[model samples]
Target: MIKTSFISKTVSELKPSGIRRFFDLAANMEGVISLGVGEPDFVTSWSVREAAILSLEQGHTSYTANAGLLELRREIADYMHKSFEVTYNPADEIIVTVGASQAIDIALRATVSPGEEVLIVEPSFVSYAPLVMLAGGIAKTIQTANENEFKLMPQQLEEAITPNTKAIMLCSPNNPTGTQLGKEDLIKLSQIVKKHDLLVISDEIYSELAYDESYTSMAAIEEMRERTIVINGFSKGFAMTGWRLGFVCAPADIASAMLKIHQYTMMCASTMAQYAALEALKNGGSDVEEMRSSYRRRRNYIVKSFNEIGLDCHTPGGAFYAFPSIRLTGLSSEEFAEKLLMEEKVAVVPGNVFGDSGEGHIRCSYATSMDQLQEAVKRIGRFIEKYKVE
Candidate 1:
């Protein structure tokens, strides 16, 4: 008798996240220093936690409105206007979701039709392509290079667009690379976006973690507000990863469509998480600054150390990761990462897992403690000494 295949072709074809592979490997091994996962070493601020506790105590345990608490939506609108200079009506233009991941998911499901193409800029967050495919949209990639600091160029964006293209996904203060596009860079890309009349899904979860320069939202660009959906959350900047809260801001029509899908699937975000996020928006600025400062310090140390040890890492303008070229070792990225994990017990993600252009490099997250980072660097230096090609 033949056995039935239960999984859908889409789910079966999806590749596992490369970041988690090394993380799981390091988990089983003792004495491993993992720089693999892109999570904060800091705990969620006490006030945020207290708010959640207080809400539970006050019997705010019931489900919130499908779009989330009206109060929270108002707070999000205020925060977005204040931080990014982008404005959205709280009533119909914002929807709080389970996390930024869900915000991206519903946005794709709402906007993309079968066979529609979404241009994904790489090295991108791993979820974007898979989410597009799962939504019955084709994921097309525009590979960015280290030569240009891994930023998406306007020319490249224009060249990648076709008649079937429906939208583009962007992540600034990007995962894996930590690259942030400036206002001028965004203006250039915005011109291309308008020329092609495509929608943009901008992930700004790391907006507050910017180091070298102020963060700019793509929706803040002239005339782009109507065409962009902003995805942000309390995960990175507020050290609230465990809270699992995020939100989306878009035009009323698009937001309504996203809300319809979210209502059926997620129902509502956690009421307690929503209350905690309210406290975060109202009073978590100082905590965010402290964590940002710590990440900035770690960024400086890790990049300098990587370069000093001959790894040739670029100074990431934002986020807590350093993408360094491991080409000197003359090994594939997977080879280098696997061998390093096995030999030195140091876990860093291989670059090729991000995209084709990411080969010959590795992404080391500086979200770990300073002492662990120092020790990991030493171990990596030793591994490099052993593997470096003459």
Candidate 2:
């Protein structure tokens, strides 16, 4: 029998994400009403799909440049400018990645030295901590509260930063919580980060999906712009998750450094995905509007449904999730989710799937249809009611 060393231990000791565990459970079970996945209900836009097909038919299967196709990079540059008012040269300031997941991984690996600290706010997207650990960096989690609308308060941030801090991740329109960081919150953070001279990794994947207010990226700030790396993708905005296309925009030096790792690890993202993403940039605004409007409808209904269950949910300003506090049930987030699934056959991810700060909440995705939302609420209500009685 072979024994694994510390090299293998790094990967093995990593716990599988809770979202996948619940999903696998739901998959094997029949009659499950799921609000577990945080993806769009909408299909890939017609134009985007057509672009991919055309690329394939035109025999563009061969690899392009290591950075990516120049035209696609230009389209991405233009989209960033027109939509976010953020400018990049596209020639030297951007690198296409295999989804924002790979971008985050590459940025951390390239920038963070082993034994350095990467400050992450939680409950966060599950990938952050694990990825930091894999790169041999310390995953420093600063737990943000629901009372703050899950915003990373300046005090909390100040308390967390150390001399060894290499980077800090700010996920606005955050995963699980659906918390959108407004201008005021970001301005405060920008000031603090500048004082500390810390590198900022702003995950603005849901930049286009904010409901009450538009997103203000940390990189949008003048001083913070130089110190920040922006990660965005086609997944959240364009309903193109499977396409796995994302990009990173940073200062020329940072982009070049990130490109070295990206080139060595993933030569370039998919050729067809690049084509489809270009189409998303060119003509996908209306599709985004449609999905955003639909998600708003679902978000409103589910927030109401959760309130009716006596679970207090903060108003979600962006993304498709509602992170409702399940504290009233006297069950942990995992317990509530499990009992609901076992008894009512409805699947929702427990809040702790994100982090400890999420312990008393459960995350419900409004990315499903309204009819499904209605039925899932009914099942969830019944399950909670039964648990109360029991």
lDDT of each: 0.94, 0.90
lDDT of 2 by residue, 230-293 (tens): 9999999899998999999998999899999988888999999999988888888889999999
* Candidate 1 C-alpha lDDT tens digits along 293-336: 99999999999999999998888989889999999999999999
Highest TM-score scorer:
1
lDDT of 2: 0.90
Residue pairs with clashing backbones, model 2: none
Instruction: Looking at model 1, report the run of 10 residues with the lowest lDDT sum.
Output: 1-10
RMSD of candidate 1 to true structure, Å: 1.0
Give the CA lDDT, 0 to 100, for residue 112 in model 1. 99
Model 1 spans with C-alpha error above 4 angstroms: 1-4
Model 2 root mean square deviation, Cα atoms: 1.3
What is residue 106's positional error in candidate 1, in angstroms? 0.3
